[model samples]
Target chain A: MTLGQQILQQLINGISLGSVYALIALGYTMVYGIIRLINFAHGEVFMIGAFVGYFIITLFKLPFILALIFAMIFCALLGIFMERLAYKPLRDAPRIAALMTAVGLSIFFQNLMVYLKWIGASPKAFPRVIEITRFEVIENVYLTSDKILTLGVALVLMLALQYVVHKTKMGKAMRAVSQDKDAAQLMGINVDSTISFTFALGSALAAAGGILYAVSYGKIIYNMGTMPGLKAFVSAVLGGIGSIPGAVAGGMLLGITENAVSAAGMSMLRDAVAFAILILILLIKPTGIFGKNTREKV
Target chain B: MKFRSLIKMGVVFAVGFVLHLLIKVGFINGYYDHILTKICMFIIAAVSLNLINGICGQFSIGHAGFMAVGAYTAAIFTKNPDLFIPAAIAGMPRFFIALAIGGSVAAFVGFLVGLPTLRLRGDYLAITTLGFGEIIRVLLLNWKFVGGASGYFGIKPYANFLSVYILAVITVVVLSNFIASSYGRACIAIREDEVAAETMGINTTKYKIIAFVLAAFFAGIAGGIYAHLMQAIMPRDFSFLVSIDILLMVVLGGLGSTSGSIVAAIFLTIVTESLRRFQSLRVIIYSLVLIFIMIFRPQGLLGNQEFSTPMLKEKIRLLFNRTKSGKGHTSTEGTE
Candidate 1:
């Protein structure tokens, strides 16, 4: 590929990957906005969703589309379960304790898979359900239909999320809780339920990301989620932790930067680029591109 | 507490030393002996990490990264011992000086990593530290000049149980002293509330940096010991998973309690080793244990409390006094 074409391909991959990052980051950012805590296990939730997709589609031999929906719904329940079981009792506890629990949860899910599978961190092939023969867009540039499908799903999901946040009753309640939990409660909005709903919403998005990821990658592995999860977190933080738009921007930027830098044969600079963005943002504009600079208060 | 406590601890340690000698010379083979040494090494790691996560209230997920720096530093020295030891013997006055320089090298790297990353708090700090851990591993993987992805190996194996225990003792002493001082109180203050601590003039940044560097220092020492013990380590060995294991030790021990960390370290090491028969089921169990603890016993095993009663303390005092007076050595007393 020519230099220009190479750069274009890299950009395409970045944006495609960034779409998933944005999807996952939305989950993180929404929950963080409400509770002011980073759910470290959010990554694992995505991982679980991917595996769920695998089991449903490959093991049960369900149609691919049906498996995707099942993954979303199943993971939504899990998101609700996590909040009720792990997070509800600790609503008043210190953020550190809850954060640790999230970390533990991440470990638990990863190990849960490990225990189920005899091999640890070993890659298992996902059935090649999606055929990518030729969906080329330009001269000597062949784009898979998987990429287009992922992009479409990601866009639709994000739009649906925005609608839920702004144009729906539950979304309005979530907004209220995020803005002021006590006041939200006084207004007769069920704060607990709203948070749960938010979790479910976020998780559904993560499930979509996971299925697409599994489909695009054509393989599933235990440790795969960790880096991508962390990268999405960086995206969430970079774009502004609580801001929806910021998460998208951050995810896209991270995905693009990582791809571009690696494509340039500077693969090692990937993390540095992410962290440098985080540090620079923290120092210069801690709120992020779309995030408002927030101060901690009870 | 009052300087007399050190004397009491010394006598107990001396007795423990004799008991250890008996065990070492007794029915165990080199394999279990190796495990004992590993337990000691992890004890140091767990205890030192407690300084930051338990005492200072900063969640650092990069313990293994600090260890990587130490391991690499010690490995370099061991790999080229002839080059440095003789130069050190000439440049310094004693063999101890070269060893001191080696430990110092590990400690200094701790300071470097701790300087910037320690500024973060809570999950943010955890994320930064986790990133640092991965950065170290990736960088080491890319460092093909030093064997890269294959790992830097073949360091001289000068470490054994005795050296590991001695270094662990030193680490415990240094950390305990540091914790008992006003600086330690500053760290506790951060744990309590950063705003309040800052308002009260604790200089949160200063104490945070200190706690992190100190944690890093001992982690480095433990790493140095580990490098010599395994005689082979890849970048994969120091992955974030290793960091999580260290975090488990600190958390399981009851964060902030030195005795808790030590107990947790030994417990986790033994349990983890024993569970190795289960293969991949081991981590699943560990993760489940962590979850169970978080759900049911968030304060951990012993928590911030001691395993023994106040009455046992008086009994121990009398026993120690008797041992000092030559009534026979008070034996079988362990902190756990």
Candidate 2:
């Protein structure tokens, strides 16, 4: 492959990776926007989604698309149950308490999955659901069908999410609650259901990301969601927390940079580079690229 | 009053000395003795973290990074014969100096990390500290001098139950006394409300740094003790999970209470050890306990209240009086 082809290949890879990140970041940003709490356990939810996909495909012998749908639905219910059980009671507690609970939940889920008879502690090879056909668009510049599928599915889900947040009644209610819960309540919106809906929406997106990720990587583990979850969070913060479009852009940017670092023959420093970017971005622009600075009322 | 307090401390020291002598004479079994030493180290780590998280109200989640620094520093100091400056001067003084150096390095790193990052409140600081810890672990893994992923080994075992137990007592005493002082009040003020403390002329930033550095220093000390006790140090040992375990100690006991930290540390250490028979079920139970605690008792077991003699006496007196009165409800309202 020539230099141009190499660059193009990496760029394609980056976009595919970025879209998965974008899906996860949307969940984080939406949740943070409403509750002002970082849902650390969302990563575990993503992991569970992957495991659900694994079970559906292997046990039921379902097709990939059907398995993906089942995974998303399972994760959506899991997200709602989690919010109701662990987070709902702590809505009025201190921020630290809520944060620690999220961390505890993350630990709990990881350990529970590990101790389960079927999952165990090992990483399972993800089955290739569909045959991959590499298409050579230009000389030496190749794109696989898997990559295109990832990008296409992610774009469609994000577009759907945008519609939900803008074009639908529940979406409008979600917007109002996120803006101000008390005001939304005064306007007769059920704040509780809206929050639950938001959680479900975000979780379904994360499940899609998880399935796509397994397809792209050909492997899934109980704890596979932690690193990606963290990076997506970085993307959420980078794009400006609570902004939908910002998450997409940030995810793409993060993916390109991470892949670029590995492309430069510094693969060992890849994870470190991502975290370094997070620290630098936070120091320079805490509100992120598209975030507006909100004044803290004393 | 100061003299009386000093006398009480002297008596406690004498008792500890006698206990040490008994252990040295094999009065206690080796297994229980090791557990006691471990309990002491956990007590120190938990109490020190309480000072920062509970008293200062700073959300720090990278304590294991500081422990790693201390452990590596002590390991290297004891291993490299050419680097043994104090050890050459005296045989026993070497361990003390190595422990001090380990603590100082970790404290310095804490200062550097906290200087800029501590200004940001809540999750930002928490994430940054956590990142810094991961960075340290990664750095340790890449650096070959300290054995990297293979771990640093072959260090002489100098840490013993007597020294570790004494240090634990000192940590508790120092932290409890500090919390009872004006500086501690400043820390509490910051915990209550940073803006209010700032308006009241308390240097919130300065006090926060002090508490953070102090906590790091003691954590480093615990790490140093842990390294010598095990005679080997590994990067994986100080992962973020360990940090969470330490935090659990503080939260379980009661944040901001020295006695609470101590009780929680000992209780958790024993419980965890006893649960080893259940294999992986221990972690699941542990996580469930954390969730349950947060749901039912978010303020913790003691909720910033220490175990005082007066309270214990009041409880005992109430118990006796209740039996005498033959009624439980009447005295229960007035006793507390």
Candidate 3:
């Protein structure tokens, strides 16, 4: 391949990579938006979702559509249960406690995967649902079957998420709770249910991301979530952690920038992109793009 | 008052001496001795970690990074200690001098890291620190001059049971003294409320930096000892898992309690080694233990209190009157 073509392929790969980040960031952004708590375990949920997806196909021999649904449903419930069991009780505790709880729970889930060898310690091969030979989409431009599927799935889910957030009663409740939990409760929005729903929705999105992640990477490992999770977190922070659209923007921007940087012969620069962006955005506009920046109360 | 505290230390020292003799003459075993050495190392790590977690009140998740920094720096220096040890021993004693320099170097790095990121709170701070740790691991892995991913080899073994216990004891004492000092109180105040601490004229930033630097220093010294004991060091030895293991000791030991860290470190390290018998079930069971602790005993094995006699009495009374017990009384209390 020519230098220009290789650079183009790398950019395409970055965008494709960026799309998954946007999906996971949606989870981080929404939860932080409503609860003001960063669910560090969310990434682990993504990992679990990938495992679920793998099992659905490999163990149950389920169809692609069914596997995706099962994974999403499985992860959604897991997310809800996590909130109910671990997070809800510690609501009144210090933020540090919640943070610690998230870290502990994350460690728990990751180790569970490691110990059971549930999906096996090694990265399992993702089931091939699509196959296309290397073919030029345009003159000297080639696209793989995997990249198209990932982009298509990510875009579709994002739109669906937008619809739910903009047009549903649950969305209103979520917004109300995010705005003022006490007032939302007084207004009879069932604050508890809304929070649960938020977790469910966020987790489902993360699951979707997870499944797509497995599909795109063509392998699933016990530790597949750590780097991607961190990347999503950066995305959420970059676009203004609480804003949905901001997450998408942040994810895409991060993906493209990282790709361009790598094309410049610095593969190690990938993680630096997110941190540098976080530092810059935090210093300049700490609240983020769509976020109503608040300050530390004395 | 400090002199009086020093006198109290003298009595504790005698008791420690007796315990050491009993274990030594009584056969701690090569296997058990190995476990004890790790426990002692963990004790130092956990107590220092508490400086960040309990004292400064920041949820520091990147402790492994500092540990690695200390570990590698110590490994680098001690790799050829014969050249430096003689000159230092002729003057200020090689062991103490090398350990101090190792710790000081780690502390300086901690200061550099803490300055920019400490302002960020909670998980942001955590993930940032975690990233730093990963960066450190990769750096050590790729820095071929040191030893690359294979890690540096051939450090002379200077650490043994005696040095491990001595250093561990000194860490507990010095850290306890630190937390008991005005500097320590300022750290607690910052943890409780940074805004209020600042209002009270404590430079919150400065104190947080101090706590971080102190934690890094001890971790460095421990890493130094670890380098000598292990005789070879690798980047993998100080991954995020290493941080979590130390954190388990801290949380299980009751965050700010000095004796709690010592006891918990010893207990957990031994338990971890034993759990190795379960093979694959080891980490899973360990996770379950942590989860159970979070759900049922969020205050940890002893909460923020220590293994004092009065504490033992209160704990017994509380256990008996457990049904009548409440949250606030059980948690958030100082051991002393």
Candidate 4:
């Protein structure tokens, strides 16, 4: 491929990668929006989603779409379970308590998968549910079926999320609670249920991202969530933590920059590049690209 | 004051001599000695981390990064022969110098990192420090002079049970004294309320940096001790997992309690070693315990309370009084 074609190809790949990151970033942004918790275990939820999708396909002989749905639902339930068991009781405690618990839960999920009877400390291959060969768009730039599907599904889920947050009753409740929990409670909104729903929605999106990630990568590991989870978090912060559109923009930006660096023969430094951006963004514009600076009230 | 401190040092030395004699007499075997040294090193790490995360109210997850800086620096100093510091000066004094260099370098790095990031609060500070840790690991992995990802080796084993025990004692004493000082009170004030403390003329940023740098300095010393004891150092030795492990010890011990960190460090090290055979299952159990602790007792077992003899006596008295009062009540009321 010519340089132009190479750039275009990388762009396509970057967008596909970014969309997956966007899906995960949405979960982080949404949860951070409602409750100020970072939810460090959200990454593990994504990992579980991938494992769930893998099992649904391999064990039950389900189609890819059905497996994806099952994975999403399973992860949603897991998210709720996590909030209830590990987070809810600490809702009024020090923030560090919840943060530490999330970190512990993250470790628990990773190790549990590692030592679990069915899943040992090894990477599992994800079976290809839909097979389509790469095709050249203009005699040089090629696109794969997996990339197209990832981008498509990510876009669809994000749109659905937007609708839920803006055009529905539950979404309105979420907005109200996020805006002011006590006031929303006074307005007859169930703050606890809304927060739980926000977790479920975010976890479901993360599950979709996880399934898509496994499908594209063709291999899944127990600790796979650490790096991607971190990068997605960076993306969320980059796009302004509590903003949905900002997450999409940040994810895409991160993907393209990382891919471009790799394309320039710096694959080893790509992770560092992401972290560098995180530090730089934090140092300069901590509110993130799309985040508005809110004055701190005494 | 100087005389009192001298007496304290003499007591510490006497204890160390007795411990060394016990080891020499075969009362403590090599396996147990190793475990004791490890427990000492972990105590240093956990206690120092508690200074920042628990006392200063800053969430610092880059402790292993600081430890790595110290370990690698010490490893390079001892292994490389053509150095500025002469081997003629290379006995106990040399070991101390190497430790100082390791700690100072890590503290310097901590200063640099903290200057930019310490102004941020809570979770943001945590992520930034975590990033710095990963950056340090990556840099160490790629940098060739310190052996990179291949592992640095051939360090002289200057650390022993006696030295580690002494250092551990010094750590606890120095930290306890520091906490009892006014600067430490400033840190506590920052933890209680940064805005209020700032309004009250406390330099929150300065105190935060002081705590972070002091914590890093001790962690670096612990890393030096660790490097000498293991006789080898690797980039993988200092990762996020190490940071999390140290944090777990501090958190489980109860935040803001130095004595609690000491006890928790000893207890958790024993538990971890006992469960070593279980491999991954051990960490799973740890995570469950952590979650349970957060849910049921977020204050931890000690919860800002110290392990003072008077306090323990008082607690026992209180318990006895409660039972005595209950006994005086009707047996049916007690049953109800």
Candidate 5:
């Protein structure tokens, strides 16, 4: 293949992967914005979502769309459950305590999934629900049906998220809570429910991302959410933690950089590259690409 | 004060000598010895992490990276035939030298990392440190000189329980002294309120970095000991999970409490070792314990309180004096 063709192919691959990252990153950025918590178990939610999707398709012989929807609903409920059970009690505790709880929850879910005998700590091959059909986009560049489907679903969900955040009453409440919880409470907005709703929205997106990732990668594991989940966080930080557009942009950039590095024959450095970008961005512009600097109050 | 401190050191050394004799005479068998050595290593790790996270109020989740640096560097020194003196001269002296080199190198790396990233606060600082840790692990994996992903093996077994125990004691003593010093107070002040500390002319960043470097130094020594004990070192061994394990020890013991760290480390090592039979249930139980502890007792098991030797001595002295003075038995109970 020509250089141009390779570049084009990598871009397509990067965008598909980036879309998955964006989906996960959305949950991270939203949670961080609302509560100033990292929500470490968000990755585990993605893992459970993939498992949910896998069971729906393989066990029940359901259609792909149905599996995706069901996974999103289950994950949304799980997210709300986690918030109510673990995080709610520690709402006024020290930030470190909450962070530790998140880590504990992450570990709990990962091990719990393994403890369930039916779902051991082994990778399962994702059944291909969509048939692959390649289309030549350019002289030597090709696009697969899986990539197209991933892109399409991610775009649709992201757009829906955008609409929910901008064009809905809940979104307005979410925005208020994130901006100032005390004022939002004073404004008669149900702060607790809004926070729960944020978790649900973010978790539903993560579920979609998980299924999309499983379908594209053709395998799923109990702990598969760890690396991607971390990378998605890096993307969230890279773009500006609290900004929606920043998460999407950060995800795409991370995906492209990883693919470009792999194409340059340094695939081993792919994971390191994301962290390096994260550190550099943190040092140079801690507020991120689109984040505005806010002064600390005494 | 100097004479008292010297006597304390002598007592510590005497205790260590007795323990060493016990291990030599097979009173403490291999299984117990292994657990004891691990307890020592974790004591060093947990105490050092407490200095950074508990005392200095800086959240560093990448301590294992510094530990890895120390382990790999010390291993390379002792294992390489051509690096220094001949094999005939290579013994305790050589091992001590390698440990020093490892510790110094880790401290330098800590300085490098802490200088740039310590300015950030809370979660951002944590994520940055975590990134540095992953970056270090990746770099080590790619460096073929240290055997890369296959790990560096055949390290000299110079780190016995005695050596680890002595070092762990020394770490605790030094850190306790440091925490009592004025510098330690500054670190505590920063932890309490960074802006307030800065307003009081504490130079918050400098103190934070100092604590970080000191913590990293001890962590390096602990890593060096770990490499020798295991006789093999892998980059994967010092992954993020190991850092979390150390953090768990510090948090469980009560952050900023040296004695608490020591007790917690010993308690956790034994508990984890005993649970080896049920491997899968072990982590689940462990995590559940952590979650419950965080929710119910966020201040930790000791609640930032220390059970110092002096305090114990004072209590014992008071009990003896009360009995000698022929005070009522009820008064003796009130003394406690």
Candidate 6:
């Protein structure tokens, strides 16, 4: 393929990968928006979701859509339990304390899975759930069915999230709580439940992202969530941590940049490039692309 | 004050001599000797990290990056004979010089990194430091001169339990002294409240950078010892996880407490070493302990208090009194 065509092809690949990151980034953005705590365990939640989906397909002989749905439900419950058990008690604690708890929970989950022998340290091949077909988009550029499906599912979920956050009463409650917890509580909004719901929603999206990631990569492993989770977090921070649309944009931008670097035959620098962009954005624009700078008050 | 410090130095030397004799007699054994060396290295790293994250309240998670810089710089210096230093100044003296060079370079890099990133606060500062760390690791991975991804090898083994123990003792003494100084109080002030500290005419940024540079210097020394101990070094040796491990030591020891960092480092290192047979269970227990500690006692095991005989006696008395009274009793030891 010519350079332009190759670039186009890489763009297509990047978008598919970017959508997965967008899905995971949504969870991080949403959680940070509400609690102002970086849920480090959110990555492990993604890893568990992949395992759940894999089990649903391989053990129960379920269809791909059913596995995805079940994984979402399971992870939604897990997210709620995780919040109630680990985070709710520390609502009034220092931010650093909560962050440490999240780190602890992340380590706990990763190791727990290994100890239980649910997933060994080695990578497992994800059973093929979708038939992939290539279609020529241009003279030299082509698209795969898997890529199309990934994009389709991600777009639908994002739109659904947008609708929930914008139009639904629960979303309104979430917005109120995030805006001012005391005021919302005084206004009769159930702040605790809203936070739990936010965790559930974010975790559900991460679950879908996990399954899609496993499907794309064709394998699942115990510690698979660390890098992707980190990148998606970088995406969340890049797009402005609290903004939904920003997460989408950041994920896409990160994915594209990473792909472009790889296409230049420097695949090893992919992780480095993501971090470089993060540091630059943090230094130059601490508030990120869509973030509104708020002055600190005593 | 000078006499007291001299006595302290004499005590340190006595301890080092005893340990060295034990190692020589094979009573410590090679395995335990290795573990002791590691404990010393971790104490240095943890104490340095506490200076930045605990005393200064900077929340830096990229400490391992500075450690890497020191390790690679020291390794390169000792491995390449072409660098200027008289061959007559070989052995222990030369190794100490290499460590000093490594530490100085790390401190300079710390100045460079801290100047720009220290302006941000809390989690933003954290992410930025983490970014710098990953960038450093990536750069090292791509640099073929340092052996790239495979790692550099065949450095002289200059580090031993005695040297490392002496350095570790010096690290604690110097840092504790620094913390007791006026500059140390300024760091504590910054940690407590940056705006209030600034209002009090403290140069918050300058103090922050100073703490950061000092912390990096000690971490570099620790890294130099680590490189010499292992006789080989890899980029992956100083990854984000290593930073987290050091952070764990700081937190578990109780932030802002040098004695706490030392105690935590020794305790966790021994625990980890003993549980090396059950890796997954070890990590699980560690996580559980961390979570429970955060939930029940976010101040950490020492809770910003130093380990002392009087404090120990007070704690024991409090425990007995609480049991006798059958009511809750809170100790106000470290509150002041």
Badly placed stretches (over 4 Å) of model 4 are B1-13, B143-150, B322-336
Error of 1 at B172 (Å): 1.2
- How many steric clashes does model 6 contain? 0
Give the alpha carbon lDDT tens digit for every residue of B166-190 in model 5. 8898899899989999999999999
Q: How much does each candidate deviate at the interface, measured as C-alpha RMSD after superposition?
A: 2.3, 1.7, 2.5, 1.6, 1.9, 2.3
Model 1 chain B: which ten-residue window has the lowest total lDDT?
Answer: B90-99
What share of the reference contacts survives in each candidate?
0.34, 0.46, 0.31, 0.65, 0.65, 0.71
Q: Would you estimate the TM-scores of all the predictions? A: 0.90, 0.94, 0.90, 0.94, 0.94, 0.93
TM-score, predicted candidate 4 vs. hidden true structure: 0.94
lDDT of 2 by residue, B210-306 (tens): 9999999998988988898888888988987788888899889887888899999999889877887864577777777778888888877678888
DockQ score of the complex predicted as candidate 2? 0.56
Cα lDDT tens digits for candidate 3, A167-214: 999898899998889899999889888999999998998998899888
Candidate 2 Cα deviation (angstroms), residue A204: 1.6
TM-score for candidate 1, please give it.
0.90
Off by over 4 Å in 6: B1-6, B84-89, B108-116, B131-150, B309-336
**Which prediction has the highest DockQ against the true structure?**
5
Query: What is the interface root-mean-square deviation of candidate 2?
Result: 1.7
Question: Is candidate 2 or 4 superior in lDDT?
Answer: 4
Candidate 1 CA-lDDT value: 0.79
Candidate 2 residue-wise lDDT, A204-280, digit = tens: 99999999999999999988887888889889988998898999999998998889889999877877776787777
Candidate 5 residue-wise lDDT, A102-160, digit = tens:
88888888989888998989999999999999999998888999999999999999999
**Clashing pairs in model 4, backbone N/Cα/C closer than 3 A:** none
Q: For candidate 4, lDDT tens digit of each residue in B1-336?
A: 788668867976897788789898999998888888889999999999999988988888889999999988877777765576786776667777888889999999998788767766647777767777878898889888878898888788888898888888989988988888999999999888888998999988899999999999999999998899888888888987778778878888898899899988989888888988996898888888878888888777679888764576666666656878655434433322
Q: Tell me which residue pairs clash in candidate 6.
A: none
The ten-residue window of minimal lDDT in model 6 chain B covers: B327-336
Total clashing pairs in model 3: 0
Regions of model 5 farther than 4 Å from truth = B1-11, B84-89, B309-336
Docking class of 1: medium
